[model samples]
Target chain A: MARKRPEPVQIVKQRRDAALNGLVHGVPYVQFLGIEFDRRGDELTAVMPFDEKLIGNPMLPALHGGAIAGFLETTAVIGLAWSNLWEEIESGRFDTDELALGHLPRLPKTIDFSVDYLRSGLPRDSYARARVNRSGRRYASVHVEAWQDQRGKLFAQATGHFLMPASKDD
Target chain B: MNPEKLKMAEQFISAVPHCKTLNMKLTNIGDGTAEMSLPYDLRIVGDPETGVVHGGAVSSLMDTCCGAAAMSHPSSPAGTATIDLRIDYMRAATPGQTIVTRAECYHITRSVAFVRAVAMDDDVDRPVATATGAFTVEGK
Candidate 1:
């Protein structure tokens, strides 16, 4: 009798999910904002559910600009980390089980973040995605766009440069 | 800042849900300038290893401060919204010290207002972050 191994895709997905779960949960601020991620392959979509506490202008009844900026920054960080974790997992350098057991990796530090507000953020659930412009050993640049209700219309966007965590060998 | 503007600024911050959530307080308001403070809170901590506040939190503080400054500007129309904001992180904020941000609406055109701000913890000499922002100045 031979034991059937899980498919390659399933194994990859499980590892990816584990990595994302750990990365997202590692940051206390991420948890504080109640941000969540939805992953497809290597891409990620960050979701911030609407809450009354997130409103910035009660008169206009809009989401706070600061809240939107924070969400965009969080998305960029998670996206960058996921890309690196995917590679590390494939190379067998990352231990998903240990991560699941509570060991977390150090997060990258933000050198700068710039946000452009295109429209007022509506008082509803918001979504964001990050695109990595550059990823190197020491530095990374990521761009993020946020929208609500409609994907074609963006309410806010940001570009952030981060100081990547030093690799263990270095 | 006049008494009317001062009262308006206070009421403005109080109406903001995010401000109340973070316990941000307006310390001072001058002509086209405002100072705000954010108390050290464990929930806003970013790095568990260092217990430092997140850059996002700092950015939030700066953004709100900038907006407040813009609103208080004499040239500012009825209201304002952030157009763009760029923040450069200089250092990590101390764990227990309150973060203070001071913003100035340096320039105002027919349609936009420009602002610059700095955030600091206990060490006022070395800033934690600096920000430059543009805000909408509608209905000149």
Candidate 2:
């Protein structure tokens, strides 16, 4: 009777979830803003629930442009980090935990961000997805699109440039 | 500087929910320029290990300042919405220091107003970030 090995797919999936949870929860600003992430495989969609404190111009009753920008930038950093996670995990260079708490690696640093407001953000749950245009050893660029109701009809879009954290190997 | 416009600017900051959340205060608003401040708060910190204020908080301050500047401009309409904004972060803001932002609406056209802003903490010489933006103007 030999000991059986755990299923590879299930183990990988669990590790992936743990890594992402650590990354998102590590930042205090994300918790303060009440942002959550839905991860399907390697893709991540950021969700910012509506709160009265997010309103900027009460007359228009619109979500604050700064809040929206923060959401986009956060998404970009997470997306870039997630894209790099697999390589570290596959090479067995990164260790993860189910209860990682505050033990996350440093997140990518934002160098610059540009945002275009397409429409007033409605007072509801806002959703955003980030697309990594390029990720190198030292730098990454991500584009983020945010919407309240329909994904096709974006309320805002942003391009963010980030300086990737120095990897353990480097 | 018009006193009426100055009053409007004060009312504007007091009315904003996000401004209240950030504890933002309007210091000056006149001559197409606006100044505002956000007191250091632990909740808005980005990196817990470093205790540094988030870049988002800095940008939010700048955005609101830009809007106030645009509204106070002589050629501005009753309201303005952000069209596009570009922000460059030069360094991390020191913790426990209130960050201040100043914005100037330098140009206005039939449909748009352009603005530039800088955010700094105690170190006025080294800015935390700089921003340039375009805002929509309503009436002709």
Which candidate tops DockQ? 2
Tens digit per residue, CA lDDT, model 2, B1-140? 66786787788788899999889999898977999999999989898889998888888899999999988888886789999999999999999999999999999987899999999999999999999999999874
Interface residue Cα RMSD of candidate 2 after superposition: 0.8
Error of 2 at B99 (Å): 0.7
Q: Candidate 2: lDDT of A109?
A: 93
Deviation (Å) of A115 in candidate 2:
0.3
Clashing pairs in 1: none
Worst 10 residues of 1 chain A by lDDT: A84-93
Minimal lDDT window, size 10, model 2 chain A: A90-99
Q: After superposition, how far is residue B110 of candidate 1 from its true place, in Å?
A: 1.9
lDDT of 1 by residue, B61-104 (tens): 99999999988888887688999999999999999999999999
Name the fnat for model 1.
0.83
Q: Identify the runs in model 2 with alpha carbons over 4 angstroms from their true place.
A: A1-9, A90-92, A98-101, B1-4
User: In candidate 2, what are the lDDT values of residues A1-170, reduced to their tens digit?
Assistant: 97876558877777777788888888888887789999787779999999999998787789999998888888888888888887886555567852375767788899999999999998999999999999989999999999999989999999999999898768
Candidate 1 positional error at A78, Å? 0.8
